[model samples]
Structure formats: structure tokens, C-alpha cells
Target chain A: AQTIHQWPVAEIKAVGSPLSLGCTIKGKSSPNLYWYWQATGGTLQQLFYSITVGQVESVVQLNLSASRPKDDQFILSTEKLLLSHSGFYLCAWTTNSDYTFGSGTRLLVI
Target chain B: AQSVTQPDARVTVSEGASLQLRCKYSSSVTPYLFWYVQYPRQGLQLLLKYYSGDPVVQGVNGFEAEFSKSNSSFHLRKASVHWSDSAVYFCAVSYRGSALGRLHFGAGTQLIVIP
Candidate 1:
């Protein structure tokens, strides 16, 4: 079975501070990866997607960038966080028919 | 543009009652449709999917959804609702033969099951 693990289950950071969130896929290689952001009680917005290592596409620009450094590793980060950046971050990978989501990481920018 | 619309933001139902959550989509052609459930503060779980086949598709926990091509709608239904079924449900659509599998999600509908 495939599993996705996201790091720093939750984070509370100060505005303008650097932020890094990661997602690692186990038991799958070269899978299409995606990053999504959800407000406290809002729908999800696709932030970025990567088809292969070192190639990421930005869907909605929220001052965030993503990178797939390795075949199974995806990283979402920013040089400085903004108060508006606080939300739930989700990582997902897709098979031919459906996508599987990770547990996700909660972020709070104060 | 491909998109999904979930009309209800919140729905309340008595436990063991029949349940239906409506979804409508706008796309040039019939896309891959799906329903997903999310427990509070958790990632989503696939409830059901409709690609190409019978209009009705069965999913986990005795849940099912009917895809209507003419109406451009995919509505989720359950025979009986449990208190544990209280959660937010999302409708998603993906383009046919999309290798990237990028999905467009609807504004989720929160289901409140009263026991």
C-alpha cells in the first residue's frame, strides 16, 4: 500500500519567518504530486503541482513555491510567511484514476 | 472552464434517515466525477467515483452517487445516516485522460447528522 507522510504536523510561526513543509510518498515512485491550501472553514485551492523531479507548476499564486527534489519527496516553502498564509496544507499524489491525500499539516502565522 | 458547485453549505439530518447531497458541474464534456468525505481536521477520503459506466456508483460505508449526463450533476446518497457520518463532503472533477490528475473541488458541504 502507498502512504504519504507530511512533516511538522502543526506549526505556529511568526509573520515574515521562513517556513518549510514537506511531503514524502512511500511505496510509489514518479507519482504526480500536488499542494493544496484550505482556510479554516473554506474549500481547498490547488497551489502547486509537480509532474516529475525538479519541475513544479504553480496553479494559484499565494506567494508560495514548491519543488520536487526527489522522486518521492515534495517540498513547499516560502522565504517569509504572511499572516494570510495561515491555513491547512495538504499533500497528495495521483494514480491513473484517483488521487490519495496525506494527513496534512496545520499552519498558523501570527 | 471545468468547475463543480455544491449548493448547500450545511445540511442537517436525523440519524438513520436517508441522505442526499447535491452536486452540479460545468464542463464542455462529461469529466471524471468524485465524492470525498473529510472528518474534522483530517484529509479527505474517497467516497465514490464515476468515470464511464453505469450512472450509479457504489462506495464505502453504504454510500452511492448517481451521475446524470443530461443534468450535468452527480449527487451522493446514503440509505442510512449515522452520527459518525457528520463531516464535510466535497465534490471534485478531473478532466478525462488527464495525466497530471489535477482536480477541481467544490465548496464543501458540511453534513450534520443528529442522533
Candidate 2:
């Protein structure tokens, strides 16, 4: 089975501060990677997806950017944060089969 | 374009009562359907998937979903739901013959089971 790990379970930052989130997948090579955002008790919205390294696609521009540095690692970063950017961010991996989601990081922008 | 619709935004039922959550999709070809459960503050977990096999498929925790091509629906059903079954359900669809498996998810239906 494939396992995905995400760092910094929770985060609180100021509006102008920079932010970064990390995700790593094990046991699956070159799998499809995705970024999603969700509010409390709300539905999930896809943010980005990457099929291979150095390639990323944006679904919704919440002033966040995604990058696939390595085959097993995906990173979400922003130079500055917005108050509306506060939400739960999730990382997932799929291989033409079922998807495995990370635990997710709860973000609060003050 | 492929999209999913979860008709009921919220559903409430008593324990031991039969449960059904409706999910409909719009696609031109035969779409691959999936049902997932998300516990409070947790990530989505796969409950079941329907591809080319039997129209009815069983999943973990006594959950089953049936696929209907004519209606373009994949409805989840359970004979008797438990309190533990209370969670948000998401319906996803993938393009037929799709090797990428990028899923388009529905807004999700919130299920509440009373004890």
C-alpha cells in the first residue's frame, strides 16, 4: 500500500507572512499528486495536480503555488498569505486507481 | 466536462435504519464511480468503487453502492447504519478508460445517524 505524509499538522500566520507546506509519498513512484483546500465542514476543492517532476497545474488560484521537486515530494508555497487563505490543505496521490490522502494541515491566517 | 452531484446536502436517520445517499454524475462515456467517507477532521477514505464488474459492489464496514448506467447514478446503500457511520460522504467520478485516475469530487452529503 502507498502512504503519504504531510508536515506541520497546523499553522497560524500573519497576512503578509510567507507559508510553505510539504508532502511526501512512499511506495508509489511517479504517481499523480494533487493539492486540495477545505473549510470546516465544507466541501473540498482541488487546488493543483502534478503528473511528474517539475510540472504542476493550478486548479484555483488562491494565491498559492505548487511544485513537484522530486518524484516523491510535492511542495505548496506562497510568498505572502491572505486572510482568506485560512483553510485545511490536503495532499493526495493516485495511480489510475484509488487515491490516498494525507492527514492534512490546518491553516489559520490572522 | 465531467461533474458530480450529491443531491442531499444533509440526511438524518436513526440507528438500524436503512440508509441511502444519492450521487449522480454527468459524462459522455462510461464513468468510473467511487464513494468515500470522511470522518470528522480526517481525510477522505475510500468506501467502494464501481468499474466494469457487477453493478452492485460491497465495501468495508458493511457499505455497498450500486451503479446504474442508464440513470448515470451510483447510489450508496446500507441495510442498517450505525452511529459510527455518521460522516460526510463524497462521490467521485473518473473518465472512462482513464489511466490517470484524476477524480472529480462532489460537494458531499453529510450523514447523521441517531442512536
DockQ of each: 0.80, 0.65
What TM-score number comes out for model 2? 0.95
Query: What pairs collide in candidate 1?
Result: none
For candidate 2, lDDT tens digit of each residue in A16-77?
Answer: 99999999999998889999898766778889999999999898888899999999999999
| Model 2 residue A70 CA deviation in Å | 1.3
Q: Identify the candidate with maximal TM-score.
A: 1
Residue B103 error for model 2, in Å? Answer: 1.6
Candidate 2 clashes between residue pairs 3 or more apart in a chain or in different chains: none
The TM-scores that each candidate's chain B achieves against the reference are 0.97, 0.95
Off by over 4 Å in 1: none
Q: Which ten residues in a row have the lowest lDDT in candidate 1 chain A?
A: A94-103
The 0-to-1 C-alpha lDDT of every candidate, in the order given, reads 0.94, 0.90
Q: Which candidate ranks first by DockQ, i.e. highest?
A: 1
Question: Residue-wise lDDT of candidate 2 within B1-115, one digit each (tens)?
Answer: 8889999999999999999999999988878888989898777899999878899999999999999999999999999999999999999987866645577889899999999
DockQ of 1: 0.80
